[model samples]
Target: MNNIVSMAWVKEHMGEPNVVIADCRFVLGKPDAGREAYEASHIPGAVYLDLEKDLSAPVDEHGGRHPLPDIFDLTVALSLAGIGNETKVVAYDDQGGAMASRLWWLLKYLGHEHVYVMDQGFAAWTSAGHPVTDEIAEPTPVKFLAIVEHTMLVEMDQVQELLGREGVTLIDSRETPRYRGEVEPIDRVAGHIPGAINRFWKDGLTVTGSWKVADEQAERFADLDKNRELIVYCGSGVTATPNVIALQEAGFTNVKLYAGSWSDWISYSENPVATGDEENA
Candidate 1:
């Protein structure tokens, strides 16, 4: 149930009778490449979750890339994966908690509390000499009941209210270029929300592309009081989950994801955007 499970911890837990391993490897370029990799070879008993097909709703330019899947649809997908209320879900991918965190946040959004994202993802697992198999896992249906927690998500209105409240820390998890409005490769807009601090999500990872130590990560987010509420946002809410996971791992007891993120914020005519590296607000 911890926000981030290190590669070592996952190796120890592999093949445990109660744990469910999910391969969430995804490539934005070849979108279907993740499923292909999963089919080629994955951890034994691991289930493949397609980010485009299984994890996201239909994409349009307006929806931003990898928009969230319907809540009920994702619930059905989890249920079909043999992930019941009691299952300890372990999600991982080649990318450092990028695609993997999507599944992690999805589980939390759906109110399943026993899920963890594998730090460093499958690459670390394979490099650690862990076992892998190509054989498919047969379906075993399980009961997954969602107790949705609305507070986990913050909408534009909620963000407005939080800005009015003093000492609110809003973090933008995009790269510095995107955060500075220097270059926008994905979304139509270039700038970030006014008054948000730039904390590139990659900063949470080491040069090896694995998550940093808990103490180090805690230090990165130490500017915000752990007890006070913090809001994390990124391009379309997909990438920000890593920051949320990192903050939670860092001992920030109260953190929420702005699911709509910069894209969603700009979608509305009223929300403000700021340019340059200077911290707003």
Candidate 2:
């Protein structure tokens, strides 16, 4: 009974013993604001996960803003957060799925499959009439061991190989505008990697903000060749997880996320970048 649970399921099981809920509510404006909000109010048993501080690594000139943290450090922090191997971790955030997917992908990278991003996150959780508590719950530290799976991640070399091979689909999860080189928000380069298709991550969610059902998701992605190799990317790899998670829920098994994503691709300057209404030309 403990796979990915919906907002309804979270509501039904709030305050249930041993249930570890993480408040991943984050704001790009005041990046530390999530921790501040957790200090102010959260679900009774929820723990705070700061997107900038706890979730991602320090920004360097190479990795852009949210680089992946060192595995050892992240595992220790997860253990300190009371998430053990067996603990079911549920992540949530505002702006739909952005921050939550970062945590979800990190957990998966560590080879823990018991974690999930809560559908709709705090907005849905609050709308469901769930009580918010000013009190924070302190729990004993649990051991979280890292077992990294290299295959779950894709690097630039692999992407280059895939580009050469036929029957491979490269998906860019950024919005149409960003993918089309309309604006450059975070990175200096606006357009996506060359030959990548656009499928914005926000489209994975229903209008109500929850993820679409499995059947609907599967049907939506049916047009894409499921049996062929599929790779997903986004700016610095933060927003790509919604599309990755959606592909998984859609029953596509051969999905891989480009961890370095467009940021790394653009860094080389030698790598090709296509722009402006160009469809795989």
Query: What lDDT does the true structure give each of the candidates?
Result: 0.83, 0.80
Q: Tens digit of lDDT per residue, candidate 1, span 96-183?
A: 7788898999898888889988877776778889888889886587878888987788877788777747767889999999999999
Instruction: Note the clash tally of each candidate.
Output: 0, 0
lDDT of 2 by residue, 106-191 (tens): 99889988787787778667777877888987877998888897778887878877784788888888889999998988777878
Off by over 4 Å in 2: 1-3, 278-281
Q: Give the clashing residue pairs of candidate 2, or none.
A: none
- Candidate 1, superposed: residue stretches over 4 Å from native: 60-63
Cα RMSD (angstroms) for every candidate in the order listed: 2.0, 1.9
* Top TM-score model: 2
TM-score of each: 0.92, 0.93
Positional deviation of 197 in candidate 2, in angstroms? 0.2
